[model samples]
Target: MTQTILYARVSTSEQDLSHQRTQAEKAGFVIDKVVADHGVSGVSTRLAERTEGKRLFDMLRRGDTLVVRWVDRLGRNYDDVTDTIRTFINRGVIIRTVINDMTFDGATKDPVQKAVRDALIAFMAATAQAQAEAVKEAQRAGIEANKGDVTKYRGKKPSYSRDQFQTVIDLLSNGAGASAIAKETGLTRQTILRIRDDQPAAETALVKWGM
Candidate 1:
C-alpha cells in the first residue's frame, strides 16, 4: 500500500508546523504520515543533513507520495532542490507541492511530457532559490539598519509576529484583499494596508523589533 507523507521544515519557533499540515489538508491531500524538522534553516541545511529529512529517505518507498509546502522545503537552493526532487522521482516516489498543486512523476515515459515536467521543475527550483536569496539579503539589510537604537530604526513595533507577517504576505500574493487578510490574520485593515503598501518596510520593522 502506498502512503502520502507530508514534509515540513520550520525555520524558527515562530513558524507553525501545524499550519503547514493544515494547509496541505485543506488542499485535499490525505496524508498518511508527517515528518518535520523543527528550527531548521532551509536556506543553509541540506535535506539529507536534517534529522527528520534523513528519515524521509529511509521511510519512503516506491509508489509512496511526498508532499511539501513548496519546493524550497526540499533543499537549500536551486541545485539541491532540483536534485532532491529528481532523486525522489527516480525512486518511483511521486512528489507534490501544496502551494501550486504541482505533481512530479517519473513514471511518465513520453518525451514531450518529460520535457515539460523537467522544465517546470527547473523553473520552480530556480525561483525558490531566488526568493531565498532575496529574503537573506533583506534580513542582512534590516540588521544593518538596526545596528544602533533598534527601537528608533522602525518607530513603533509592528503588531504582527514574523509568522503572521508571513501569512499576510502569502495571502497578499494570492490576491486576497486587505480586509480579507485583516480578518483572516486578526490584524487591522490599516496594518494590512501598511504591509501591502510597503512590504520591505514591514519586514525591516519585524527585524528591528527582533520578531
Candidate 2:
C-alpha cells in the first residue's frame, strides 16, 4: 500500500505544528505518520541532515506520498529544496504541498512533461529561497532603522512571550545550559544563548519586532 507521510519543520516549539496537520487533513490526505524537526532553522539546516527529517527520508518508499505545508518546509535554500524534491521524486515518491495542493512526480514518461515538472520545481525552489532571504533583509532593515532610538525602542517583539522569556531566564539562573533550556522550552539553543547572554537586548528586539 502507498502510505502517506507528513513532514513538518519549525524553528521553535512556540510555532504550532497542529496547523500543518490540520491543513493536510483538510486537503484530504490520510497521513500514516508525521515527522517533524523542532527548533531547527530551515534556512540553515538541510532536510536530510535534520534528525526527524533524516528518518522521514529513510521511511519513505516508492509509491508513498509525502506532504508538507510548503516547499520551504523541505528546505529554505534554492538548491537544497530542489535537490531534495528531485531525490524523493526519483525514488517514485509523490511530493505534495498543503498550501497549494501542488504535486510533483517523476513518474511521467513523456519528455515534455518531465521538462515542465523540472522547470516548475526550479522556479518554486528559487522563490522559496528568495522569500527566506527577504525576511532576513527586512529584519536587518528594521534594526538598522531603529539603531538611533534605542531608548524609545524596546526591540522587535520576541518569538516567545514575556512569561516564556522569564522561564528561560529562570532556567539560566539555575546554571542550566543552552541545550538543556532549548530542550525544555522548544526554543533553539542559539536563542537560549542569546537570552542568557544579553537578555535586555533580546527583549528589546522582541518588543520591537513583536515576534
Candidate 3:
C-alpha cells in the first residue's frame, strides 16, 4: 500500500518537531511516517546532504506521497529545490505542501498540464530562495545595527525565541486567533497580539536579540 510521509527541517535545537507534525495534521495530511532533521540549516545544506533527509530518497516508493511544510524544506536554494521536486515526481511520487495545499504530479501525459506544473515548481523554488536570501539579509542588517552600541539600539529583548516567533507568524497566517496561537505556542495572548499586529517588528526583535 502507498504511504504518506512528512519531512521537517528545524534550524535550531529549540525548534519543535512535533509542532511541524501538528501543523501538517491540522492541514489535513494523514501522515503515515515522519522524518526530520533537527538543527539543520535548510538554507545552507542540500536535502541530500542532511542525515534524515537522505532517508527520504530511500524510504519513499513510487506511489507514496512526500509532504513538507513548504518547498524550502526540500532544498538549500532554487536549483536544489527544483531538482529535488523533479526527481521525486519522475519517480512517480506525489509531492504536496501543507502551506498552500499545493500538489505536483508527474503522472500526467498532457503536455500543457506538465508545462503548468513545471512552471509552478520553478516559481515556488525561486520564491523559497528569495525568501531565504531576504531573511539572511535582514539578520545581517539587524546584527550590524546593534554592533556599535549594543545597549543604545538593542531595545528590550523579546520574550519569545526566533522559533516561537516564526510559529506565531505561521499560525497567524493560517488565520489562527491570538488565543489559539497562544495556547498552542505556550505564549501569552498579548504577545501573540503583538506579533499579529506587526510581524516584521516581531521578527526584528527576535533577530536583534539573536534569538
lDDT of 2: 0.78
Off by over 4 Å in 2: 148-211
> How many Å off is the CA of 21 in candidate 2?
0.3
Predicted structure 3: lDDT: 0.86
Write down the lDDT of every candidate, Cα atoms only: 0.86, 0.78, 0.86
Residues 95-151, model 3: lDDT tens digits:
999887899988899999999999999999998898778767766776687788877
Once all C-alphas are superposed, what RMSD does model 3 give against the true structure? 2.9
**2-74 per-residue lDDT for model 2 (tens digits):** 8999998767655556656765786688889899887788889999888899897789999999998778889
Angstrom error at residue 49, model 3: 0.5
User: Which candidate wins on lDDT?
Assistant: 3
Segments of candidate 1 deviating more than 4 angstroms: 152-156, 169-175, 193-211
Arranged by lDDT with the best first, the candidates are 3, 1, 2
Provide TM-scores for the models.
Answer: 0.86, 0.72, 0.83
lDDT of 1 by residue, 15-48 (tens): 5678778778877999999999988888899999
Task: List the RMSD of every prediction in angstroms.
Answer: 2.4, 12.3, 2.9
The 10-residue segment of model 3 with minimum total lDDT is 202-211
